[model samples]
Target: MAGFLVSCQSDARNATRIPPTPSEKLKSNWQKDAIDALTNNIRRKIDLDNSYFKRARIYFENEQYDLAINDINDAIENKDNVGDYYLLRGQVNRELNNLDAALQDAQRAEALQQVSPELYILMADILQEKKRFREAQNYLNRSLQMAPYDGSAYYVKGMLQSRIGDTTASLGSFKQAIDLNPRLLRAYQQNIIINNRLGNLNNALYYNNLALKRYPKDAILHFERGQFYNALNKSDSALLSYNKAAALDPKLTEAYFQSGSIYLKWKMHDAALKAFEKVKNNQAEYPQINYLIGVTLERMGYDDRASEFYKMELEKSPENQLAYAGVVRLQRREMGQYSTPSAREPAQPSAPTRILDTNRVQIRTIQPRRSIDMGTDTTRKVIIR
Candidate 1:
């Protein structure tokens, strides 16, 4: 809660895009159909424009924003008269963080007479990202008025409310989103975060459980459940949850980091080493991962390797006290001041959390550079550092 805020903006621009051949093999059935349609149309030289549009939508759904942009561009080039094509391109550009391009496309779409609630929502979300909050609010209000039961519009409203320091209203908006569309996973995630911000860990945990019931295979939710359990001092439960998350998505390096930290705490050095190694292998740049590895190595009496890791961490973060302490402890050990590193450990690192993006399921941890403004009153605007 201190570091991770669920922003109501897409991070799809930075997400990996699957290539066409791999996508055909690895993507969902709907994505496969779109690809097949595009492929067949290309081979037959028929209806290629609509085929590109359909494939672009599939790419968007897969979070392959770059490919989505390419396909949508091709579609627009083929048929610039269609309003929906401009709207789709605008959406793809928004996902790509091409805000200026997105705004231009939105304007084009509007001029083409595409005046739907979805288009309004897209324009509002784009404006929100641009920090034009008042304009965003106006567009969002219009979308809500046009489509009262649209869960996505409500979700965007929740994000706007949260941004402007109206947590109570934000929570209500998120709840309305959930009530309207139970499958809106991001709304559930936001509710869990707001509950945590309010110092209601139990409620946060309850929401996590609720989300898991709906999205049991969601690795990020499992990772969050682990964090909640660890906060509640349920270490055993935390480990189980973390392991489950890691199993679900081996790319989820934070799960390995958290599980390893717990293993280190339990003095299970070998297990700790393996978990940390998995994290190091998958994501060497993970926050303080080198420091954690150094501590685990020092605990296991591999002083030389431990010293190397400590130096590596210091290279990345010269101001890190824990890594600096690790180096000093090893130096002292070399001087025979201690037979082994002392029993007292450096202060454990704060638990790592994630920067949750809206409209996509990708999760990544941000360094604990600053704390959140967890004021008890919901009136305070939530600030992400």
Candidate 2:
């Protein structure tokens, strides 16, 4: 999705007239029947009041971004001058993947109420997505000035700072975010990555384990721990962690892929093929699994099987260069399998050492450009700049 955190601000003067705060508790337990009743009632005879704005949070809490947008649209139609309604609409539009509408709403909200802290954070997010880093920083600075202890603001700041190669600043911001809200998984992920990049392995492990203690069954966290251990050349530990991750969530293809790649690198071609086999029937379309299996088969001296695997990979991914290259190598192998180092080498052996790439088999893990905080639940959030 686009790079904006989706949170709303109250319109000017409407904050004082609030019912029970949605932040303190959801308006209801996300009851769809009540939502439909309110929606139908409003559509039948729209109330020209701020109640729609308050009800929009219920839709958001229910993960009904489209319904939320419709509610906010009605709220704006009734009171176009309200800045909070505009902010609400902006957030709703962002969730609906309508960036233009989101920006328009944000601009309108700013025009109505220029000093809203959440509005500044939202602007920072939009600017960051547009690659306007300097302007984004200015917005984050303004947001921080207004809400110094806001964890979301600090998380956005950390994400932006990391984008600009300010690792130290970004780390500081993530630390502050964690200090504000220890359960912020993304902030912990960023801390682990940045410290590992700086070769502070102990620090990385420390932070990741801290989060794991709190979120033991988080498959993503275990996968990330595997990444850290792999980075430090702890192959056995990494493989165990990856296996644990795969066992926790059977559809975690990256765990299998990485484990297979590790086995391939270690010359355990049988174990490697077994791991790659586990990756084949996963749900998230692990495109690299077939090619990796082909490589593993080739390494095991089964050229014909390897060729079949390579051909299958090509069928799955026509533009797979490594699969094509593997086919070429198989075609030209006049001598035996162990004739040369080049003959034994895979076209793209998953790092040939570590299994850390920006793209995982399904989702990008650990690297926190996207979800650096706010928890990876059903919240619509973003990393500004």
Candidate 3:
């Protein structure tokens, strides 16, 4: 895994992700079941052209790519108005990790004279994925011409701009995406990251707040809010946000870790231990939690126990150099040479961990995880600070 901590985002041009609304949600489950039943029935009986294509749409929506590909392939075999079939198949192919196939299907769709703004967007995604930056931008331009108000198109444009390191243009494109579609969650996330990278703290916070208002129950959003506040050196606000994130999603290790990190920095060992404890039992995916816990114990005068945790941390992360150092220091202290290592060879070194860093735990931006949204082609990281 890349470092959980990252510097974070810039500007964007990419496709837009369609946000689900209340009415959409209502039909979602019913439609999924209805479509599954209908498609299966259609396949068993007539398997008509329209039936195959309509079934393909349901499969696509529900992410049944394999079934969707089969249905669309059947739909395309008949030859009339097969453009949409080709486009849908191209998208399904992309989902199946068949990039070349996706490109070919898209080309076929365009060749069938079924071109639309959506087709241009799909072509752009394939080109961008293939690393054809210039051609990708051209397709994006074509898409905008056909459907300038398309939110997803604006997002895709932003993604391309950001990929090429055009921070200013990327940021502008992201802002446009949000303006066009207020519920574009990823766009809001990008704004927070980019504004922070550019030292536009106020703008970053503004985006954070906007996201929270729309998604108050999303723990990740609240966790991000904490990181933003911490980065701005607003310790109290950071703590509150972190606490809220933990409350909303008790299993969110990052939120607890952040809260503990703050308490540790403030010299509240008890509080820090409580936070690190949460991380310790939470599957141990994180890199530094064990190390931090050891340090917190040591600070609270539990030298022997602290040494054990430190050694455990080293066992988990052999690269944690500080764990080695902490072990050495604690050993020397036990031998009545607290100030320095013994001149003679000492006993074999053990490990220790509890962040094992300076007095302060650093706030950091985590690299954004893969967006996975159909709109997000590339990736970025989030700050953990």
Candidate 4:
């Protein structure tokens, strides 16, 4: 697994205070004239601050997370008391993988809006990232209490429960979210995964079907349904689902790989070769494709060709069990024995014939050893001569 870490700097300064709404115009006029002499200098600073925040929003929306963080840092340094500003900064920080900084900024936002469910949700997101499931649950619960109708809160809680392996609770939370709003995509995916884990394949198929209905072009949904069918040993259905997924999105490598495996099992060698060939071309570094190619070749009785592919797989993964097993099988077939020891065993003579042509027959009795050391470092001696 790769570790993603990010650093962030936040400004803790408060924004310039604004006068009460009733006196705002009068106070603005009174201050405007007096501050007019220094207006140009102050205006430049204010404009710079505004530009910083504007650029921050643009960068964030454009997914330039590092640039967004820098611009937001400048904006926060100028004035940190803006609740929305802190919220935006926290969002950028989270995108940058600076969960600690994100948590702090989110907490600051919460301080500004003490009962804001959005702030609590942000905090819960950070807690969940840190794997503090209990704390995350508390924050999510608080957010739900503040706004019971927030379907997103339920969805998030469901995700948190799923992470902690609490499938039952997760199912309830997902269903609640779905009940509130049927369009929660994350809930649908999570529900499917949880249902599959719980051996409720029928429910998984149903939810996956529903997800496909909503997201007709979603390759993942088709791929997941294909996997469920494959698990049930319904290869034809699995093949159709995989074909649909692959047709919708040719880049879905798992769909191709799985379909290839199914084709291989069914002895549809040509189809298996084609699927694995695509995987090889698209994802050359994947060792499994090489192993599969070797298997297909072995099935076709091309021992030499199969051996080459198996060797290629071993080059990528020295301890490749399938590659080694292929090598062993091929060697056995080539040498006409499963192992070298059996091939080297001396042939025994037919049972002594009891006939007049034998004239006189001398019988010798042989005794077997108590044990044999199949090979490496031991000896066995029989008492009989």
Best by TM-score: 1
RMSD to the native, candidate 4? Answer: 20.1
- Candidate 1 regions exceeding 4 Å error are 1-38, 58-67, 93-101, 213-217, 244-253, 278-288, 311-385
lDDT of 2: 0.77
Q: Can you give the lDDT of residue 314 in candidate 1?
A: 98
What's the TM-score of every candidate structure? Answer: 0.69, 0.58, 0.60, 0.58
The prediction achieving the highest lDDT against the true structure is 1
Quantify all predictions' global Cα lDDT against the true fold: 0.83, 0.77, 0.77, 0.76
Superposed model 4: Cα runs more than 4 Å off: 1-82, 85-108, 111-115, 159-166, 247-251, 281-287, 300-304, 317-322, 328-385
> Per-residue lDDT for 1-385 in model 2, tens only?
0110011133326352333333444556324434554455456553533547756867765557877787777777777777788887777776566778788889998998656887888788777767888998998999989899988688888989899899989999999999997776778888988998898988999999998987888788899899989988999999999999998998888898899889889888888888889888774357677788888888777888889989988998999999999998888784544343344556544445666776655764586566556656657677799
Clash pairs (backbone) in predicted model 4: none
Q: How close is candidate 3 to the true structure, as a TM-score?
A: 0.60
Q: Clash pairs of candidate 2?
A: 5-382, 10-84, 11-84, 186-372
Global Cα lDDT for candidate 1: 0.83
Order of all candidates by TM-score, from best down to worst?
1, 3, 4, 2
